[model samples]
Target: MAQDRAQKNRPHYALASVDHALRLAVMLQVEGPLSVSDAAERLGVARSTAHRLLSMLVYRDFARQGEDRRYHAGPVISLTADSQSRTALLRTVALPHLHALVGRLGESANLLVLAGDYARFIGSVESSQALRVGNREGMVFPAHLTSGGKLILADLTPAEREELYAAQRWDGREGERPDPAALEQELAVVRDRGFAINKDRTETGVTAVGRGVRVGDRVGAAVTVSMPTVRFDESRLVDIVSALALASRDIEHDLQAALRVEA
Candidate 1:
């Protein structure tokens, strides 16, 4: 009864149309670009309503219509007084999707970005199982050893990759540095398959599948689902790959939008 009273006493004031319009603005800001139909589906509003809302946002300079006819976050949002860093923005935009992926696949999910010769985990959502991989945020792994890092590496041309490999300073550990020919072969598979997998590569008994997140034809980051080798099943690889691909699209959309806003 006291909880009911507390709930009733809580202040509430919201304008439905305005609230939805603001949400649409946020979606544009975080999810990159959207058409009226996409906004309608995401916002759960009628198409006409979504169109009206977008039009108003465009007028206010809070969103802009691109040459592709998709709606993008406008000057007002980018020029806002908020001092949030790009890294923070990326984490904010990616965390929810990572959580959703974890919920769907019952596996740990991560967002990683290329940092020099390493792939750095910037965000992670851990699985609920007792034996699952723990949080890896802020951790860095050699680019060649990690699925996410390999996907980013595969984005480079053969000559470019060769140049990078030649310039790399490797540790004395045996097999730490990848053979140029073998690495190129692996990259070819990654390109053809549109994803990369690491089985007992980064760590023994751990497996990870990763897909690159592209922003304007460049791989800016990667999204991955990781699990223990004991729990991993090759038969379910298709399902995991599909989930990672979907999440990658969402992240890429947000990344492209963010880059445009920054520009």
Candidate 2:
């Protein structure tokens, strides 16, 4: 839901290039294939600037150039790994566990990483049930408003928090920002509980539970299980949290083994 709102306020002191890149990425995600000229027009940048940005995106696997010369969502959008970038590796390692989680819980699950102020879902597995949460790969959500996002936010230090969410940064988007004191209290609860649950915080009729995946000292990603709110059972929270933890551990173990092999 990166483009969930149509008229989000521009951040104060926002870098034009970075903003353009992120917006272009979202456009590719939400609107499908786009020509360079169209990208330039959408971003209001010179064609050369758009081309350069598209080149960078191609290099990072965020986009792929088709034979038609249009840019489209790349393998990264589908969580395919070329075994080069760490993000790809993360998705590769996490997917098996995500599928296992879906099998165990009968709910869709996703692996997400912190991307600037948003949480980007890098891998996702949908449940087989006729009525279930759908795939959410390649989507971004405000970090403060998602279960996985809150876990990533809780991992940040106070100074890091200030640096990322400083008032000046949200100048035009003040209405969308979380209350500082409330956010601190919520993060405290997230840290203390070792997991997070969002009951329709980002989307109505959906609920998600998340646990952090740690890579040595830093939390690298979050493993989350999402389901329709009608099926949510608070009484089953403990069991769901346990399954998420097991999946997280499996992913971490694989990541470590992969690193050792690389070393």
Candidate 3:
């Protein structure tokens, strides 16, 4: 009966195409580059089918093709390797600051880091209020959809942002995928204001404010406060931003100290 219940809880169907693509993605991450024939042989699929799968991966920035006709992990995947250790360290150093933000703002606070084209919640401190937002650690959301993501994206140069968006494959759902032109404009506002705000953008009735946490010239992470729209007050945004900025600086200081220790 326990086994049966577990089976019932699992997804009933799996798309072969999706499974194939996922397998290929894992291989690319773990084993590095591969050619079409290599992927076909490994997956036991036809070369033509492998090419189609690879094309989708390339379109999504999960993989890239080189002049030698070999496919390696793309910018997103490469960034993952570059940022993984830093992200782990940031999470450890930012936890106390996140808690402090929650105490000051009475709203849930999170530490997010960029992982490829998504923002990953690395640490969080829930608000004390009964109706407050809950912890979101381990959640991954598209970078363009969340305030934290937008804040980090705003740090990238226009050309870098465009390159990141060029091969994206958009979902059919409205607002699931960002329009490049619109995103460009929104990022401009983020840069000018030194922060980003999302009101009912990522989720209905949810609002978030975020600012980038920098390690020198680069944005290393983002600090965010989230609350229900009903509790959101535009008048308090400035104060909230102030609290977050202070918390970011605190985290940044600790991160620098930690790096110096390692050095």
Best by lDDT: 2
> What would the per-residue lDDT of candidate 3 be over residues 155-175, giving only the tens digit for each residue?
988887877676444344333
Candidate 1 lDDT over 100-181, as tens digits, reads 9999999999988776667878778899999898666656787877889999999977776776667345445324556778
Compared with the true structure, all predictions reach lDDT values of 0.79, 0.83, 0.80
Model 2 lDDT at residue 34: 80
Cα lDDT for residue 45, candidate 2: 85
For model 2, state the Cα shift of residue 20 in Å. Answer: 21
Every model: Cα RMSD to truth: 14.7, 9.6, 12.5
Error of 3 at 199 (Å): 1.0
Sort every candidate by lDDT, greatest first. Answer: 2, 3, 1
Residue 48 displacement (Å), model 1: 52
Candidate 3 residues lying further than 4 Å off, grouped into runs, are 1-83, 168-175
Where is the poorest 10-residue window by lDDT in model 2? 1-10
Segments of candidate 1 deviating more than 4 angstroms = 1-84, 171-175, 260-263
Q: For residue 63, what is the lDDT in candidate 2?
A: 94
Query: Model 3: which ten-residue window has the lowest total lDDT?
Result: 1-10
